[model samples]
Every structure is written in C-alpha cells, then in structure tokens.
Target: MVSQENGNQSQQTGGRFAVTLPLATLRGVGVQLGGRDILTDVTAQLRRREVTALIGLNGAGKTTLLRALLGEIPYSGEIRFDCVHGNRQQPGHIGYVPQRLRIEGNLPLTVFDLCGLSLRRWPWFLPLGTRFRERVYAMLDAVSVAHLLDTEIRVLSGGELQRVLLALALEPTPELLLLDEPAAGIDFHMQEEFYGLIGRLNRERGVTVLLVSHDLTMVSKSVGHVWCLKDGQIECEGSPHDLLHGDALARIFGSHQGVFGHRH
Candidate 1:
C-alpha cells in the first residue's frame, strides 16, 4: 500500500524521468481497419538505449502497430516523444526499414541514388560536394556495401538490396529505428551478420530499436523485452526467459505452435 503524498511524489518523479530520458510512450493505443480491430487497447513504453522486439504469429498486428507508431496508420492513442534539444522534426529522428525492397521498372538507379534519396533537403539531385559524397560513402561503408556504390539497384541480390535499404534508413543518424523482418528471406549467415550490425548500432548509437520479427530464436537472444501479440491484443510481454517458459509459450501459441504459433 502507498500513501497519497508518496503517490504524488512518485508521479512527479516519473514525469521528470520521462522528460530527461530519450523514450517514447504510447497509451491506450487502438487501431481498427475495415471495421475490424487489428490492435486494441495496446499500451507500450519504449525506453532509450534498449531493443524492444514485437513478436507474434502472422496477422497478429505487429506490423500494424508499428505502422501506427510511424503515423502511417490512423490510431486512437497518444504518442509522446521526449525530444531532447531542438532536432525533433528531423527525418533521422525516426528511421524505418520496411519488409520488402521491391522496386519495379528498370530504372538505372545506383546504390548512390538510393542513398541520395535520403538527402531530401539538399537542393541538387546528386551528391555534389565532397562532404555529401563522404557522408553517403560513410553510410554505405557502415553497412559494408560501399564497394557497391556504383552498382545498379536492379542488379543487386535480395541480401544486397536489404543492406542498401538499411543504409538509406541510417543516413540521418536516427534516434529511433524501426526494422520489419530485417532478416526475412535472407540466408542464415546474412541474417546473423545483420543482427550483429543492428546490435552494434543500438549499443554504439544509443538508438532505440523496435523490431518486428517471426524468428523466435533470434528474438529471444537479441531483445531485452518482447511483446507477444495475438488476435489484435498483447497476449503477453516480458523477457524471453520469463515469457517462453514451458506452457506459457504453449498458452500464448497453442496447437499451431511454430515459431509464433496461433492458439486454437
């Protein structure tokens, strides 16, 4: 039990903590599409310098919830960011890498072009000065794709394309990074390498990461916290060890038990 004055002090302390830290808060978040609730009454708090994984079966609304956070989908909720300093509206503040990188038509856009797209505020189309070129090269180098700067996008493999997309997302040095199945459809080695890079990015950049993935093994090892979604609701959320113990996983994902099996 807590006293009234103590509760007030605690609340004040919590507010101060929020203001000081680089965190994002979502309260009573709900998303409905086509008269169907895809996400209902979901509440989550993402802290800075930590990785949060969104894990669940297909159609569990993980991607939908992420989209809502990006303001791409209409949602009933409050998303407050503790934007330190004056760099709040910058594009690099929230970087997103979508699931697929399929671009149709045979446009001869090079890797440099893909990276240059991130420089929307620049007046010239291509990277003109040494500073801009260095920045692009640095981003490509960070993803280990600098050698392919001149390679055409249409000619790159799936894994190569994913790297380029990641480079684009990291161009602005974003505070919050959202990755949707960054390892999907790639080979096992590439997946491992990508995870290593993501881990380093989180650790070194102090970037808050939110990952939506179906790979339970990787999710269990990589993230500090996991939010398991089912039927448009958060079924359970905790550390992997706590949530994946014995029948708890079975309860969240019953007979169809695969990586993130659906209960039925």
Candidate 2:
C-alpha cells in the first residue's frame, strides 16, 4: 500500500490511533465475480476501535472489499481477526448496514415488524413479547428514532430508513460495523447527524468501523484513516488529512479532480 509521507499535510490530532494494534488484517485479498476480478491483492489493516473510510470511484471494488470481509462472497487471501477476546479465523460479531434495504413490492411492514423479525428467528406472526419490544425500543432510542417504531417502513424517508437500519446494526454491540454509503440519499443535515453518531459510537463503544462512501468531503472529516481503492486495490492508506489534503488522492483518482476536492 502507498503511504502518504508528505511533510506539509496536517497531522491528525484526534488520537489517530487509541490502540495501534490491528483488529483485523487482510493480506493479498482478492475476489472474482462472474469470471472477472473484483478485488486484487488488497492488503490493509483495520486498527482497533478506529474508523476507516474506503473511498473510490464507482466500480472501484469498495463495496466488494466490505462484502469480502463479511464473508458473503468467496475470496482468495487471508482475513485474520485478532480481537481482544482472542485470535479468530472469522469475525466475532459484525454489524452491517447496507446502502439500502429493498423491501418486497409494496410490502407493508412497520418499523417494529422489520426490527422484530431480525431480532428473532420465528415466523412473523409469532407474538413479540414485551422484552423483545423493550429491546427494540432501546436500540431505536439509541439512534433517536424510537418514536418511528410503529411507522410503516414504506412510508419512511431516506434518512429515516437509514437511521432505522443503523439502530438495527448496533444491536448486541458488534465489534465491527460495516457501513456502505450510509449517508447516501440523505440530506446534508441528516448526513452530518449520522456521521456524528458513528463517531460517538467509535469513541464510546470502541466499535471498529470500515465504511465505504463516495462523499470524500464527509469521509475526510469523519474518519481517522482513509483507504483509497483504485483499480481493485488499495492505492494508499493514511489519515484523512494526509490522504485527502495531500497528493495521495490526486494520484489515486487521477483526473477525477471534482471528486477528490483537493485540487482547486
């Protein structure tokens, strides 16, 4: 991976690493879909309790990397986890909030029904006990959306749905949280609120986050470390200031000046 060694870049001051230990490491990770390589020899580390952002142009394998970590797709390489509990071949507890949830055509499921179904494995008709409701309430309350518990999922706006999804992902307090374009389709204000919540989670709960987003401006301000994926590989990795404000993004993105925002 390329390193940003530029001297003029501002150093990240927010304890860029509370713990330098790596929570997870990916070495020579590669993924192929439909006989086409989606990721190639991607090597990177997710530091313990640090928020890392993955940024790249469309089809840059950002989401593929996240999916590979989730083990939803087969890949060629070693994904090793060395959490505080113990070393493991797979992740312990992973919370994933996808870019969007696609409900079946015109399905009329309330926020309660959606969260309740995921919280338990039984049929949808099965009675959700008071304890279950209380648990869900606490989860929603964390994201400040408990009042929308009974609202129809279909009726929710983009921001509301994303918040609801975030609440669901925080359950059981996962060790690693994977968010894909979490702020996409939401207003700027909502995006700011969402990112603030994520930062709080990292600081308070020590939940290691690996997020994939196209919003370079937000990623620059919200994350500690930023990974630039170009042509299916990690082109560079460093603090947001080092990567975003330095020449790293220019080299990784090439002529995509408007996207990087570092060039006038």
Candidate 3:
C-alpha cells in the first residue's frame, strides 16, 4: 500500500511519473469561439492526487476551459507537461470524461465493444485477445460495472453509460483525469453515490482529478480546491470552506438570484 507520505510527495511532485520532472504548467490560457471570448486569461496548475473543482453558472465558460486544457480547441496558452523520464511522445497520460455523451442508437456496439476501443493497439476494430479481455474485465470490475459488459449501449441508462465511460477512461491509468460534470443528468441519489465513488478513486488510486461541475453543494463535498468562473473569467479561487462561508460567493453570485444560489 502507498503510504500517506508517499502520496503527499507524489502529489507535490505532480504524480509518480513526473515526480522527478518539473510540474505541469498552464499559463495565460485564453479561448474565443466565433469572436466571443469563452475563457479569458485563465491560468492554473494541476497537482497530482488533488481534486480541483471548476464551478460556475450555465454559461460561465467552465466547459470551454476544460476543452482548452485538453487541447481540443485552439487557444492562446502554454500547457506544458514535464515528464521525468524525458519521454514526451505518448498519449495515455491524460484521461478525459466528456459531459453528455450522445451515444447513437443506430450504432451496433456493446459495453465491451466500447471498453475494448480504449486499447492503444493498432486496428481498433480487431477483436480483443485473452490478455486484452482480462484487462477489460479488470477495468469493468474497477468501475463496478462488470455486469454490464455484455449490455447493449442503447439499453443502458445515463448512469450506467457514465460508468462505462469511466471504465474506458481508467483503462489507461491516466495520470490526470479530467471530468466535465460527471454527475449531471443523473438522479439525485445516484449523484451522491457517484461523488462518493469519485472521492474514493482520488484517495485510493492517487489520480489527479479536475472536474467541471455546476453542482456547488456536491462539488464542495468532493473537491479540495475550487476555481469559480463567471463571464469567461475566474471570479474567485480557494478552498470550499473559504469561498462558501465568506463574502466571496455572495460577491460573485449572490446578486444574480435564482435557485442556483451564489456563484463562487
């Protein structure tokens, strides 16, 4: 078992893989879609084994910031991941779970089919061999969705599908896990359970998590650090206790009254 001291050191060093290397850095990050600024001058650093929550309103550019971090969208910024081994030519270090994955019913695929697709082997359509099958089963068991391995994608509910996606993402044992509202659209009870699972993963696997969430209450309970966004900018950033009990939340989101409550 990994000791707490080791975990803390791993986190301080930005995970085991990059422990000896310089930390990952994001500087002056900015993004614009169709001449509209979605993320402006956003900068942050992600440490290993730390859960960072990105919170904001419906259109506060949280999703845009996540995309920018993944390099999925063009943006002006420097995202540098320093590898201790000096091997920068790999694609499995970062794992991403997208929000609202629209799986088409017409696609003839099973849960196992999607999970096997995560393998980095050539010819993605090739059938999984015994070794790969074992790996797939292990991943399914890890996510507690082994029973759904044979289930059809079209038949699974939202929460089941999300678990399948998480299993696929974890197959690579990514150093950095990026989740965009993993609990959205699920039932209230399931949301609570899902956050608990997420918290466990962070604590046990030492996977650094950065989640973009609008559920402030849930996020407050799950994450260690919070970065609140508003109008394409960071309104406030600190611990959940610091932002919630103080005037920071009221200043950013209190004036805009609704069921959503304060912003930060």
Candidate 4:
C-alpha cells in the first residue's frame, strides 16, 4: 500500500483526454463505523475529466469511500474539491448513480414520474407543465430512453433503469460523477454499452468520474485509472494495463478471485 504521505505524489495520466488537474483530493482520510476502523489513512486523487475505477472485494469499503467523498457520512481528514475557481467547499455539481433503487414492483411509477420527482420541485399532485415535460424528454432522449417516458418504472429492465438513472444524474452538468456499481445487474453487452456511454460523456463533456466496480475486464476497457482497495485502504493504483495484468491482479485480489472472474 502507498503511504498517505506519498499517495498524492503518484503520477496520473488522463489517457485520451490529456487531463492532469485533480478534481478531488483525499488526504489521510479515515472512516470509523461501530468503533471499527473502516478506512485508515486513505489518500488518493480523482483526476479531472477522467474515469477512475475503484475495485476490491465485496466488503473492502469501496462504497464507503464514495459516501465519504459525497459528504453523506462523517470521516476524518480532508476531502477537497477543486471544481471551481477559489471554491473549496465542494464541487459545483456532483452526479451520483447508486447501485440500485429499491422500488416496489407493484408501484405505479412512470419514468416521467421518477424523473419529475428529482427534476421538478413541485409536488407530485401537480400536473407537469409542457416545458418541464419537454426538458425531461430531452434528457431521456440523450440516453436513448425518451420512448420510455410514459412507461412505468417497475416494468423497465435492468439496463433501462440504469440508463434512466444515468440521465437523471447528468442533468445540470456535474463536474464530478460518482457511480457505485452502476452496471450491477445489466447483461454483459449492455454493460459494455453503458460504460461506452460513460466514457463518451467523460470525453465530450469533461466530467470527472469515480466508478466503483467489480468487473475487472470491463474496468480494463472503460477506465483510464484503476484504484484497487483492500481492507478499507488503497492497495494499488495505476492504469489498467499497469495494475490488472499478470501477477498484479493476483496480488491485489488473491482468494477473492471467484467474485470477479478474468482470463488472466
């Protein structure tokens, strides 16, 4: 593991984009839950306009780190956001797509209703205005799900639901995007397409992405940087080619290989 003091000094490459700025920096960040140290002396940087994959075992605190960065949980040390000029509080906007949304299968919630709940400030009883509906449609259209606008959320497939959630997250154009296993239940082909969409967004709009994933093969293809977390701290970080090949993967993952399969 890289020591906290030396973590920030590690080199970062942006792959196709040539990005070098640090979008977010974590220094000596620690998280404790139920009197147990969930994370100790964690330090890392999420490069601006780049896709970073956070990979590890199931209980390695990958989601915990994301929650800490989102300010959703209490943590020690500092998480600084350099999204805007002279602003140190937080990013101007942060788009988040969680692992899953637990909605009752019987609930009569349409895609428009789901989007409106977040996008529209008005109460659900109020009729959605024409302009608001248009904005929502356009957002869905960008993700190629506009046809599902009136479709019930419960009836949508795993991939469709993910796309809808992604659309909701993209609005207002966030400087940072946090995805916790965004493609968890989707089929492999759809997962590839989804990652492609994410990569396209990073390249086109310059959105910095911090992705938590277990699919090492997909991680290798999708992200520019990979951070392997183990026992609640970063064990290794580098490009996929540097960290995911040969003995490096075995060193980081070890007995947890069954969780995420790979040819190498």
Checking candidate 2 for backbone clashes, the offending pairs are: none
Per-residue lDDT of model 1, residues 11-105, tens digit only? 22433333225366666788999999888877666656788788878777888887887778898867666544222233547888897666875
Q: Name the lDDT of candidate 2.
A: 0.82
What pairs collide in candidate 3?
A: 253-263
Model 4, span 1-264: residue lDDT tens? 633322334343443323454777887889998899998877787777889999887777888898888888899999887665332545447888887689998999999988889887777799989999999999999888999999999999988999999999999778889998998888988998899999999999988999998788899999998888887678878889888875887767775547664212
TM-score of each candidate?
0.84, 0.88, 0.84, 0.88
TM-score of 3: 0.84
Residue-level lDDT tens digits of model 3 in 62-173? 7788777676889886766654323331347667889878778788898878876656476976657888777788888987888988889999888888888888777667
Model 1 spans with C-alpha error above 4 angstroms: 1-22, 85-90, 124-127, 259-264
Worst 10 residues of 2 by lDDT: 4-13
- Lowest lDDT sum, 10 consecutive residues, model 4, at 3-12
Model 3, position 39, has a per-residue lDDT of: 79
Candidate 1 lDDT (Cα, whole model)? 0.74
Query: Which lDDT values do the candidates have, in the order given?
Result: 0.74, 0.82, 0.72, 0.82
Q: TM-score of model 2 relative to the true fold?
A: 0.88
lDDT of 1 at 87: 22
Which pairs of residues have clashing backbones in candidate 4? none
Ranking by lDDT: 4, 2, 1, 3
Q: Which 10-residue window of candidate 3 scores lowest in summed lDDT?
A: 1-10
